[model samples]
Target: MNDREGGPSGLRQRTRRAVQAEIAATAMRLFLEHGFEATTMEQIASEIGISRRSLFRYFGTKEDIVLGDHAENGRTLKAALEARPADEPPWEALRAALKALVESLPYTPEDFLKITGMLHASPSLRGRQLEKRQQWTELLLPDIARRLGATANTMNELRARALVACALACSEAATETWVRSNGTVDMERAFDEAVAAVRA
Candidate 1:
């Protein structure tokens, strides 16, 4: 109730999200400690001092608990891009927003590895992850279309989607580089290089 480390002022929505993130983190730890399939929602809830039902209130399934809520990230990205200086080119704005986002990412490298490993182990989770990406792509497509002042059928639409796709590819490369470097690599630099590689 103390604004959770004196973060944002209003604690209602933010508090709920903070609690949810804690649950997700706790769940990940339990999964890793006790083995993924061996970990139970009840065990996670008990460890976190919450009822299993309360855990369910935040995440419908075990997979949801681990993935956390990525919608916030997508919204933050879109808002950051929209807030960029109007004079900047759209691609520049997107790249800047993404750089800011990578720096501000809440999940640690351990959490990243946990989720990545889980996705690799489970087909259902992999499908869901892909679905989530498609959903983000759909959201991005509209924003891009508006930025280009063109419909989805236009050449601008293709260019916009291509840019988003290219950005995603760069992000993937940056992430892999980050993991390989054991989080020692400058993620922003890797991302910048990835984008630069595309531009070259």
Candidate 2:
């Protein structure tokens, strides 16, 4: 068996991640140049010098290719939230986590606008975006509950869920405002205000 740490398995995982990133970059370029619906799996594979089957192995569908990084983002958010000091209030921890999430976006504001535009223009992508948000909320719920020291059935658990929801809403609003401003507005500041508003 291969060593678990920084061995063949690690190398393979890194390679896979690299290939996936390349595929996503290539697909985004094509989608932007052409249109999301006009872009095809075969075209993406051809541009990346990979077989169509290989592309399928990395991403099940065109929408998946566009939104694949969201899973990683969710993991990042969860980790950031969990890493917050135990003594911090739940809202404070959540605010920091949401800021971390924004900072972790792999693209610049211009690219974010392009990607968000593409999603807005495509009904399928918009649906997938909502699905991804729901997935993130679910991924974070248990951690939020844990941080609040609440069992599943406790009122504190309900409060934790509500706080998570508010944070998410604030994040969405901040992102939209930033995108609309063409990146002029400060996303972190917007998020901070949003969190503060929720707390009040």
- In candidate 1 the C-alpha lDDT for residue 176 amounts to 67
lDDT of each: 0.73, 0.84
Tens-place lDDT digits, model 2, residues 43-69: 999999989998899999999998888
Give candidate 1 regions above 4 Å deviation: 1-22, 32-38, 50-54, 107-127, 149-153
TM-score of each: 0.71, 0.82
- Cand. 2 Cα-lDDT: 0.84
Q: For each predicted model, how many residue pairs clash, with residues at least 3 apart or on different chains?
A: 0, 0
Identify the leading candidate in terms of TM-score: 2
Per-residue lDDT value at 73 in model 2: 87
How far is 34's C-alpha from truth in model 2 (Å)?
2.7
lDDT of 1 by residue, 5-84 (tens): 45555657678878987887788788777766788889988999999888888888887775556566677777777778
